[model samples]
Target: MGALLFRLQQEPAWFVPLAVLGALHVAAVAFRILSHLVLLLRRPTDLCHRYGTWAVVTGPTSGMGRSVALDLARRGLNLVLVGRDPAKLQDISDTISCTYAVQTKTVVVDLALIATPQGDEALRLLRHAVAGLDVGVLVNNAGLAKPCAVYLHEADVEAWVRMISVNLWALTEVTAVVLPGMVERGRGAIVNIGSGTTLTIPSFPLFSIYAASKRYVTQLSRSLHVEYRGKGIDVQCQVPLFVETNMTLGATASRKRRSFLSRLIMPTSDEYARAAVCWIGHGPLCMPNLGHRLEWCICHVVPDWMLDELCLRLNLWHRVRFQRLRTMRASRTNVVNDGCLPCKQV
Candidate 1:
């Protein structure tokens, strides 16, 4: 034993570095494998031609919601499309019907003011959507991201109310309406399209209202996942960063707009939707982008004070970027203090 110890002590110190590198490589491969495995386990491919599983998609007329509908329809699940735009909803219905050869239903009820009582328009619409079918999936993807000014969301009161209704209240209501049936059936999946901004510390630049609403979603999904875990109900939140959507384009180019570190990170909608949909059937709380994941980790691991300082700089830098946009706007569109004019239409 003494001879062995002396020999080991004399071994080259370079082995430590080599061992660390080897360990790191192993960890990376392990993580990659695990990620794909989980994804495969949750992917909708398993349910192809699985007729009679009703999947209701909120905000199905646009953005992530539309993409999710396409994914589900491709797999042959009967779909009920929900959104405020009847014309747009009808267009989607026709296309999905012609392309996928699956049954499609439509509900044009606005969630902005859905009531609790029977005959209440919103509930009535949802009830009718799944009138005779068992809902196996629900996607709460409808929301609004409005422009703002100041350190927090001091936007017009009406705008805040609208955002709150669509982003938070409507989502909660839909989940509540469908949860009982899911619990009774003992098998269901719920997907909430939340925001990555809520997971970060600095809050939403000038549009804090939007992030605040989404924060409620993450909390609700986490709580429900715990409450309904054994009942066969799966709830999840999808947080994406800088997704390329009309919403993002409008919000990023608004009069009160700004840019920051997020400008360095741009994620495409197609990839985000695919990853988020893959996560829904597996578990809850799926964040797809790498930049968002890193920011979330730093927020958790670092001291609050340090994060606070960083957040402050990020806020100001974003504001400056917005100001630059204002400066670059057409001279005729310039407003007070060199701000760009409000967008002609959202």
Candidate 2:
């Protein structure tokens, strides 16, 4: 330390610029963190006033989508809930209508099949549903993931196709359906739910398709934000890490039981949704959960190779556990079948 200081004193001219550069970098980082804190501390914007009277949310029956839909309704915006199941959609719509003084409408569409004849008809229904209504917000929250992690070659082709259809095609088509009205009116907010896998790591091996599709979402959101900013449309992609939703419940269950970090990193769907609602129309890309944002900061410092290896191992661990559980369930079913009496004997 003394030798370094003596050398710096001897060459103060060269050292001063380096020192200044280091200080500036620190200041920039501090400013970014402080800005995020301010965003977290501030009040949520009034959706009904800032955007419009009606907000449309896809995949509104469960998980983050449901929570966001309810939060928007609580803020006095009428809701148009879109999901695959009519009963579940109606259940949530009824809840929103009963608890809040807001009107609710349910649109049943299986977004995964959006390319087929049935899907075209459903898309027509969706277009008809939002026509002439003042839709101020569009939440593209509907998405799909592989049931279990697997290598690219081992993955089922049909399952991957479905995931791509829902995560990419459906989101794009839905945005296309809603964005026209927002453009005509010159004011709107579009929120796309993105995964943290794409942002925090260089590569996600086993879940390649899912991560790749979300990367597309991030790019699409950013490009749209730039293209439509002049026209009064705010396009944002909210990147969340793991949340306790049905999609992740099985994958994360064993990990959470074994690792304290898993429990800490994964927030409940409602908890994440609450944070998500406050951040709409604020930025083009955001990590809504405070814990997730902290993790993201730490991830940036990690070398890409190290992050890539870590993600591979972690996903492999989940994949193995998932396979084991499936095998166990299958064995149990076989045992039950063997123990059952013959039909004629019964």
Candidate 3:
């Protein structure tokens, strides 16, 4: 410490300036970390009170969507559950209604059909479903992904079409359907579920379509937040890292290779949703889960080229694993068809 002080005194002009800049940088980083810590430990926002009473969730039958729906219901908000399947929607609706003393409404619509003639009908139905209701929150959680990672040209055109339709077209249409009401009421929150793959890395190689779709979501949320903040609306794009959703778990189902570290880093859908609900009506773009936030920090610190290469390799590995799982499932289906054993869906 004395030597540093002597050096600073000896070269005050350059040394002192550099030392001040370094200290300022360190302080900025420490403040950021401390703020994140506070967010992590803070009590959840009373969403029902902050926003209005009714909350709408898309793709509420599974994964983060289902979990987020349940979490919001637990917080005393009535739910409007939208999905493709009537049965699954009813199941989750019943579960929420019975479990949480909250009003539950289910609207069955295939969001993937958004650009079609049926989509117009679906949109009308969606509009009617939420019309005149004090719907204050919209969770555009419905999304689609390729069964496995593949190059754009090599991937099925139809698969890419459906993904874009659901991820982009559907989300936009649903938001349009809901936003006017919010604008009229002058209060609401829209939470769009985005993937961490788009933000943490510069390039996601094999899963280009999925990554590109989520990038659109993040950009939309930011623009909407800026546009609507004055009107008493909060638009947030909540990006999550590797959560143990059906998408990720299905890849590793046949292989018992998930170690402790993997589990530590990869939260389940329910776990991520718990943290996710706490951040609603807050940030424009955020990683809600603490583990994901840590990974986000590390990814930013890593060199861009290094992150790109690591992501490419990891996705390639995932591609291979997913293909193998599909093959196994096919084989099991054939055996079941042969009446060799009882059938179980993966």
The lDDT per prediction is 0.72, 0.88, 0.88
* Superposition-based RMSD of candidate 1 using all C-alpha atoms, in angstroms: 6.7
lDDT score, candidate 1: 0.72
Candidate 2 lDDT tens digits, 129-197? 999999999999999887457988888889899999999999999999999999999999999999898
Error of 2 at 337 (Å): 6.3
Extract clashing residue pairs from model 2.
Answer: none
lDDT of 3 at 239: 90
- What TM-score should be assigned to candidate 1? 0.74
Judging by TM-score, tell me the better candidate of 2 and 3.
Answer: 3
TM-score attained by model 3:
0.90
Give the 10-residue window scoring lowest on summed lDDT in candidate 2: 337-346
Worst 10 residues of 3 by lDDT: 247-256
Predict model 2's lDDT versus the native.
0.88
**Candidate 3 lDDT tens digits, 1-346:** 9997787778857877788887986676677667767977888787777778999999999988999999999999999999999999999999998999999888889998997999999999989999989999999999998734887778888888999999999999999999999999999999999889888889988888899999999999999999999999999999988888766744367335867666557877788888888888868998887777667767766899898888789888888887888899999999999999898997
Q: Rank candidates by TM-score, best first.
A: 3, 2, 1
Clashes per candidate (backbone, < 3 Å): 0, 0, 0
Pick the winner on TM-score between candidates 1 and 3: 3
Runs of candidate 2 exceeding 4 Å displacement: 1-7, 10-22, 249-264, 332-346
In model 2, what lDDT does residue 286 have? 91
TM-score of candidate 2 versus the correct structure, residues matched by position: 0.88
